[model samples]
Target: MSRERPIPSNGIVVLGASGMLGRAWRELLEELGINSRFLGRDECDITDAASIRRAIDGWPIVVNCAAYTDVDGAEAFEDEATRINGEAVAVLGAACIETGARLVHYSTDYVFNGQRDWAPATAPPYRTDEPRDPVNAYGRSKAVGESLLEPLIDSGKLDALIIRTSWVYAPWGKNFVLTIAKLASERDELTVVNDQYGRPTSALGLAETTLTLLENLVEPGIWHATDGGRCAWFDFATAIAEKTESGCVVKPCGSDQFPRPAKRPAFSVLDLSETEEVIGPMSPWEDRLDQVLIQAGLANKRRLRKARK
Candidate 1:
């Protein structure tokens, strides 16, 4: 078990507050009565060194959720992606070091090439110490970001935690679940890729786990986090359709059927042993999804009831 720490007096500064994971973290903090300051891209340009220093100057904790997430778009704009996802993070690390602020940065499974396929029934998920070989522009950019923080963490110049997660979705924002839910409602049939394998992580659960880490003052290092269990994208989509009562027929297909500019890994399931040891086992993906959907449904009902009044 990790040692406990008192919450920072200045509260946390959440960068990229408008993004999906950031919003989820904000919601979780509010529910738990933790104080935090949220800053969107418009409010704080992470790429700007002055902006980063200014935003984090007084805060004792900084949670960075900003990133260049467009996988396909990255192929065409690798430089821009590197600037935001890689270079900017280095600047943030320096700022954290100077201000004595603990930095909590989010990373992705794309840091690994995903060439090695794992059978969940037999093989353990990819460990945290696995070699990284990112396959696409997006992955390379994220890998660079991680590399920038390594030295700072190694020398103890900055107190940092780099958490890598995958296939994250929430009720809000542009995520796989929301996309599938919309298509299932409007389309009669949908073809999804089945070759890709990974855990479908919930933003809400990830947020909660992050808070747990902060409260426990877990050691600063690389950790893998996601909802428990694994499934292919096709299975994920089908489950969503079933849960939402969407009449769409989901058909599985190979990645070749719908080729994109960037290549995707066949398997990217992350091992959560290290994370679990620190914060306990995460909720299963299906259960998290069901909870989000239920909450969304109830929120909608309240909205409708209010409108009627």
Candidate 2:
């Protein structure tokens, strides 16, 4: 209801504009007739304060989609990761403050320890006010960014909102759905890790929710924007197989079977109580997948038929 209120054509600038989420948000902004400036890593190095300041010189809203998303790679290159993920955010926050601009940022569910469940079958959902306990380098970096920007928000130099999401996927980038779909078509059988559970958020869905929030930029805080369901990686892979492929033998395996360098949270399903309370119930994961597949032009009869075998 609040988003229905109009925003003047002050123009929104989105960083990471070439990435999956950035592209999706760009498309939606175009549809809404809200002109946006897209700054890629090369165009405006977020690591440089002056670069960030100059890029956002005239924009009123700065949506920072730029992030170091390599979870395991962060383990090996924490400094570079921190420079991009943590310190860059502070610089951008400062730029937003100087420009009198609102900063919208992306965070991860990894901020919490996997031992704690945000959503319980018989209890209320986790509030945005819950304490964070990051378990890994990447999570720690993101937590640091969240900490660095707090002062800006407090001083009223910046009106910042952080959107913490889990298991983001999109057709435009390298993600689980695209990987699974490609594997299903190429391989005869596959074994997927089944032990991990989280919400599979489509980038398009996040982009739409962000636009809705921007349309009502006055209402700002940390919000969760993800698809409205939960499933294990294997379950999600199976769903992709089912939707894109009529039938594919997607067997369940464990993280032990295909272990990686970084330790992933066993449960990363973020409760959407706060976001849904603001934006209404999000579309289901399967529905979101369908839309993405169509958008990617991967839902053709031939592709589906090849995936089925």
Candidate 3:
């Protein structure tokens, strides 16, 4: 992000537009009747600067949802993760600068080490300016992008907006919600970790709120976006179980119960005060979850709630 105002014209180019979050952005743009063009990795390989330039040339704004998103895989494939999620961003940033386009990049909360593990009940949300101390290779890779771009932003050489979101799920694509929903449907019981705590985000709600931020001309800088409240992974999985009415007993257990290749933060909730100040409070993750479950035909229609504008 830079000091200059971040605004874009009607036409938008969404790289990695076939991903879950990308589809959300595409659907929102179509619903709003905005002109937006989407490109898959084959059409616009972000690793190549020329491809990025070609894809984003005429668009006033470039929303990049692309990244090496595998957290656990990063431990073994750190180099590949760094190349795609870390290095390619340098190319994207340069292309955006050359094309004179406003760049909107998505980041993750894993950039933090979640040192608040000792005090989950009293843990505070991580701020945008916090010193990054990632605990895993995936987080390290993402941190590489933030590190590379901050200097350019400080020098007033780039026009960009880095938005950080977490625990994303949608009606389509692979995600925790769908996995738990399907498992709950087939299994009588499930075990979820109760140690990790973070906010859940709906891809649709996130897309809409991002559009609202663009419309409101919020400051061009690092910002955090997510649902209204925070909860443990066990809580989230349990909620999905109840919503699906799969009659699955979701048992809570410590993180040690099931280890992962990636070491996730114990407290990764991002502070939303900055984002809320501009776009109003976010819709509850539960309400947003209901919308997605309904779309996936996993929730009862009676659980419907009003969607965000």
> TM-score for all predictions?
0.93, 0.92, 0.94
When 2 and 3 are scored with lDDT, the better candidate is: 3
Per-residue lDDT of candidate 1, residues 32-115 (tens digit): 677788999998999999999888888989999999999999999999999999999999999999999999999889888787
Q: What lDDT tens digits, residue by residue, belong to model 3 across residues 165-259?
A: 99999999999999999999999999999999999999998888777777677667788999988899999999999888899999999999899
Cα RMSD, model 3: 3.5
Model 3 scores worst on lDDT over the 10 consecutive residues at 1-10
lDDT of model number 3: 0.87
Q: What Cα-based lDDT does every candidate model obtain? A: 0.87, 0.81, 0.87
**Which residue pairs show collisions in model 2?**
none
Which has the higher TM-score value, candidate number 2 or candidate number 3? 3
Worst 10-residue lDDT window, candidate 2? 117-126
TM-score of model number 2? 0.92
- RMSD of candidates 1 onward, in order: 4.6, 3.3, 3.5
lDDT of 2 by residue, 186-289 (tens): 87788999877778899988988877877765355678888987788898888877777535789999889997877887777787876777678988897788
